[model samples]
Target chain A: MRALVARGLPVDFTWCEGEARARALSEATGAVGRRLDLTDRAALQGFLRAVVDEGAPDVVLHCAAVSQARGLQDLTDDDWDRAVEVNGRSAFALCRALGPAMGARGGGDIVLVGALDRGQTLPLPVHFAATQGMLSAMTMALGKALGPVGVRVNMVALGPLGEGLSRALPASLVEDYRAFSALRRLGTAEEVARVLAWLALENTFMTGRVVTANGGI
Target chain B: MTGRLEGTRCLVTGGSRGLGRELCLAFAREGARVAFTFRRREADAEDTTLRLRALGCEPQCFQGDVADGAHAQAVVGALTRAWGGLDVLVNNAGVQHVVPLALLEEPDWDLMLNTCLKGPYLFSRAALRGMIRARKGTILNVGVFSSERIVEAPAHYAAAKAGLRGLTDALAREVGRHGVRVNMLSPGLLDVGLGRMLMPHRVEEYRAQAALGRTGTAEEVARMAVFLVSDENTFMTGARVTPDGGL
Candidate 1:
């Protein structure tokens, strides 16, 4: 994407990854990276307002989340709210809020992250599936509605990404995870980031769509 | 960014129109040798090929009806033979009969099922032979929103897309050990040639109910498809992407 910007496309970005990372991204791409905790409604809206004020962003990419692999009973309402708020709700809010500007401008793109959890259930992490299922619905409805405005919506579904929350799993689960992936291995951040970049930057015609970037499955 | 499919050979179905045409152009831009199938429009195929060739990419078009068996075999076989080695098969040829599920016609049901479901199966069955031989290949099936949502489609279309999703997962596992990756590229409301017809309203009606308040384009979906087929996505399978703007 930086390369595309360098090639002279008017590029802008607002990252919620955190202050330092967001700042680095802003510097690398010359994009306005606003570091707002996506879960904080007030902060998110305010920050996005400021971003819209500064200059309307034509594309909005929701890439923030909190993950935990607790058992079913171990899951709590707080976790649900947090997951919903952070992982999925933030996207809903951003689109709900900032979509008008892009539409008014006559065009833009919004891409979210999804998972296979909606269809296939895993061992203990059901919340991930639940929110993702809602997220999928939102993607579909939004696509139909927003397509007329030239504001495209889409999602890149994900599989397990790392050894962080996953390494602590049972050996059997780990084996299952490995075998479940078409590549039979773990994915890397560069790999995931590349996907994010593609959904945001290239292939301009696809919207209200879901493309699984989960290796080969 | 490195153009992972730089020299890989690819074949995309429904290349005579919309998302298929966009995929052909994008792949050619990325330095891939492409062989895309067109059902009957030799003119559209030529236009696509002309555009691809203008990009300094090798492109060829074949004629075949995805709904038929012999044509599918000949087309898939021809592509595999032309390149001497095929690396990616994008099974994307599909048709939709969008109506209130309650009012969908029986013939429309068959059209939906045969085009979306049967096409992928036939193409995959044929492509898998060469892929397993090479021990490396990618199957990117273009699916629909019906797989995840019960949008107003004939039961057949929805069921077929749902089945396609399942096929992607199961096939991903079945061929994982063979070094083959199976994936589905499911687009929601899109701005491609078909989307313009699917929901002809001005779209505000749809937006009022949508979470994202908009539709997407074929290029964006194509980009996602390309990334999935790229080398970077090395550990994901049985995944579904809802590129619908936050619906």
Candidate 2:
């Protein structure tokens, strides 16, 4: 939100699970914030209808995801279902609801945010990786599906970053990730957001590609 | 020719028919003790078992849903208890539906993700325990070659299979130090199983795009699956080997 606002683009609407956070983000970016639970089909549909009524935004950036660090032995069915619903299913729903409108209106850009663990040498969240995989492939399929209409679909795969989710990871693991990267440091939120902004706003020719911003990890 | 997988214990999911059946036969021919799981199709399971028996190796067939963790654990448990340990596991069970994204419902999405993506995760997770303990094992995830190519009305299938590629890469990295090699085999349009369902014109369309100018056979892909899980695949891990006739 900050990246787009900083770039002088008015982000019309934003959403999150918590109302307070949504309001906070609304204040931060001057975009309408709606408290949305993506797992609820009715609520998601309502949100989609509302967005469509307001006219489909020129760019749709799907970055919302729910994940937990559970090994195979510890992961339960509920965990899998939640991750798939929130991370995987919601993206599909967004594209399904919003893609045609974008295509009909002379094209738009849809940027999916994913992880940079294409072949991580370290142990990471397996369930999260699976959903990222789903997102990546969907990007390819949608890229081709919507490309003829001028819409571009792509994914920006980010490596270990210094803020947000990485902050929740173990300090030791963060250190290990830093050493693993060729740049020997974790990326900043600005750096990742810049990449997302670029793919969403600036890139013209690249589609169906995973533009990895992993510091050469 | 000497058997490449002599004395090896192998398990293949969804082995009662199609590419899964072909993989079972290939492993048995290479001199491995074969076990397989099928969701339904008792007659086909019986036939596959008989075929394996003709190759002079006893085969076991389990009936269960690959997506269920308990079923995956039970299958791996039985195989490990009976054979001491499992050496190779092929995550091959899958279900596909062709529907445009606009018309696709939640059930359609769940079915594909459960069978194609979650099945591999559950089975691989169950098998990894023994593999990690023994410091040796190979897991081959069967994916589709169309994951990279544009296909109509297969968004769910493409997502699930491509997700398997993600799992393959991450799992390989997680277990490579333990000597458990994990790789993905994405086969292109073959004249078997799912490919048989394609319209003739669609088949021709795919052929025209391929360098080989023809769809491949399941046998050709199964051979590559064998090589991937065999000793010959010593140095390769976290790789996606596509046998798509150069599409």
TM-score of each model, in listed order: 0.72, 0.55
Runs in model 2 deviating more than 4 A are: A1-217
**Chain B TM-score by candidate, in order shown:** 0.91, 0.97
Tens-place lDDT digits, model 1, residues B1-247 = 5466798788899987789999888787777888899877889888888888888976878887788888788987777667786888898887745566678778887777887878888888888988999888888888876577755544666688898888888888888878887877777767775467655563555445455555677887776677677665555555666555544
| Candidate with best lDDT | 2
DockQ of 2: 0.02
Model 1: DockQ score = 0.33
The DockQ scores of all candidates, in the order shown, are 0.33, 0.02
Interface RMSD of 2: 12.6
Scored by TM-score, the top model is 1
Best by DockQ: 1
Alpha-carbon shift of residue B227 in model 1 (angstroms): 3.7
Instruction: Give the C-alpha lDDT of model 2.
Output: 0.79
